[model samples]
Target: MFGLKDLIGLIISCFIILPVVTFIRETGYFIISGLLGAKNPRLTIGSGPRFFKFKFIDIRRYYHVYSWFSFDFIKAKSKFAYISIYAGPILINAAVALVINALLANDFFEDSKTFWNRFIFYVFYFVLFDAIPMKTVNGKPNNGMIIYELLRYGKRIDYNEDPIIPGTTEAEEEYQKEVEKMKEIKWKEVEEEETFYTDKKG
Candidate 1:
């Protein structure tokens, strides 16, 4: 038999808790990547086909709770891409945990490990789980594994062939923009290197 608190917790977890936490994580990725100059970085929430979708700035939010973050391969420099991808779950989880702790200290939540407490703990668990490299059930790499691979080999584990959201042509446009941005970045680097060499010579 579920008590009032339990029932309320269940409802909030289903409708609010999961969705809000997931949004914060995904949006963190989007914001960090964009600030790092990623071009058309596509941020997604949930795994399945999108039921509700919209674009904000350079982000596309898929309205569901179960979520992950991804970006165009060519969108960012390798280091920036790695940080942006890795920052989502880790940064948000830490920030949320701190806030939750403060709230609990203020008696916002009960001292016992209730639903709210457990929710906060679960968020922290997710951060650790993702930050530790491991493979998923289907043998695909998790975020930590991807970050490790990227740092070591300059490549990431290719989890899927089609990295596109269903029923959307955004990937195509994003790819084109990614290519153009990469080209620009490449030329800029080359020009900067030449200038540096010229200045050294003179």
Candidate 2:
């Protein structure tokens, strides 16, 4: 059995990923060169099954199709009409899991809505996942860019947290090198952060 900490971490990550899955399922489209002439196009599913699938069309192309579909599933070319289709599942699925956990514990999160819960979950999820890169911009895993972009674009990174661009800043470069060192040494979070800040701050 996993410990409470592990369970909590899982839920947080799930919430973030679930919405992205939903967004992709709904709005995003993939094209496959392997679409067999024999198979029924009528029965398309996730990752579209084809004898040989090819790269999905660009996000822009999918965007056009989704727009016409009226924000539904990929039912119409224009259905599932949003770019953040994957985002829905990432958010909702995690929420559902957390909700179930809360209900079993007789904690409703006050009708499944609490700002503090949301914030903490986001923080946990961001810390874990921001370490791991997400694939955007043509399914390319943008590694260090994740945390950088969140800080840069979303302004989630605190002013107190160093504002170094991931690769450009010497401090950030050192930070990343330290992260790699921890990974190499398999240092746990407490040890990693402690050492990282100690060296960087000192």
Per-model CA lDDT versus the true structure: 0.65, 0.37
- Winning model by TM-score: 1
Q: Which 10-residue span in candidate 2 carries the lowest summed lDDT?
A: 63-72
Best by lDDT: 1
In model 1, the runs with Cα more than 4 Å from the true position are 1-5, 43-54, 57-64, 68-75, 106-115, 157-202
TM-score for candidate 2, residues paired by index: 0.22
Tens digits of per-residue lDDT for model 2 on 97-196? 4554566467555664443455445534533442444554444333234335454564332333432111113422453586588576765777889999
lDDT of 1 by residue, 16-79 (tens): 7777677676666766766766554555555433345456323323444766555544445666
Clashes of 1: 0
Worst 10 residues of 1 by lDDT: 160-169
RMSD of 2: 18.1
